[model samples]
Target: MKVNYDAQNDVLKISLSSTPVRNCDFDKPGVVLGYGSDGSLVDLEIREASRKIDNPRSVDLAMNGRSVHGVRLL
Candidate 1:
């Protein structure tokens, strides 16, 4: 999984899997959902992320009960 944020566009993208997206849907005005060929959710995109999230620049990850804070791509 990977998360990326585009500060200039105020967009945040979270990839849930390595599957290639075959189609995309507008979940809402500022949200989009990506689906793979099999129609399984593959990723998510949020526009105007800064206004939607408390701190758009930060990321917190959790897996199997373990959590990580202050994660960034670089």
Candidate 2:
């Protein structure tokens, strides 16, 4: 998995897989979902990310109920 934020565009992209996207759908305003040919979720895109998230350039990740990583600033 990979997360990237384009501050210039205020857009955030989260890539869940490397699969080729077959189609894209707008799940809601300013949000898009990409699906693979097999109908599995491939990635997600959020427009106007700065307004949606508290801090669009930073992220906190956790796994197995533990803070396994430090915050990352894009």
Strongest candidate by TM-score: 2
CA-lDDT, candidates in order: 0.90, 0.90
Model 2 local distance difference test score: 0.90
Provide the RMSD of all predictions against the true structure, rounded to 1 decimal: 1.5, 1.5
Model 2, 1-74: lDDT tens digits are 98999999999999999999999998599999999999999999999999999888888888888774447655
Query: CA lDDT of 14 in candidate 2?
Result: 95
Badly placed stretches (over 4 Å) of model 2 are 68-70
**The 10-residue segment with the lowest total lDDT in model 2:** 65-74
> Per-residue alpha-carbon lDDT of model 1 for 1-74, expressed as tens digits?
88888998999999999999999998589999999999999999999998998887888888899999977644
Q: Give the poorly placed runs of model 1, Cα more than 4 Å off.
A: none
Clashing pairs in 1: none
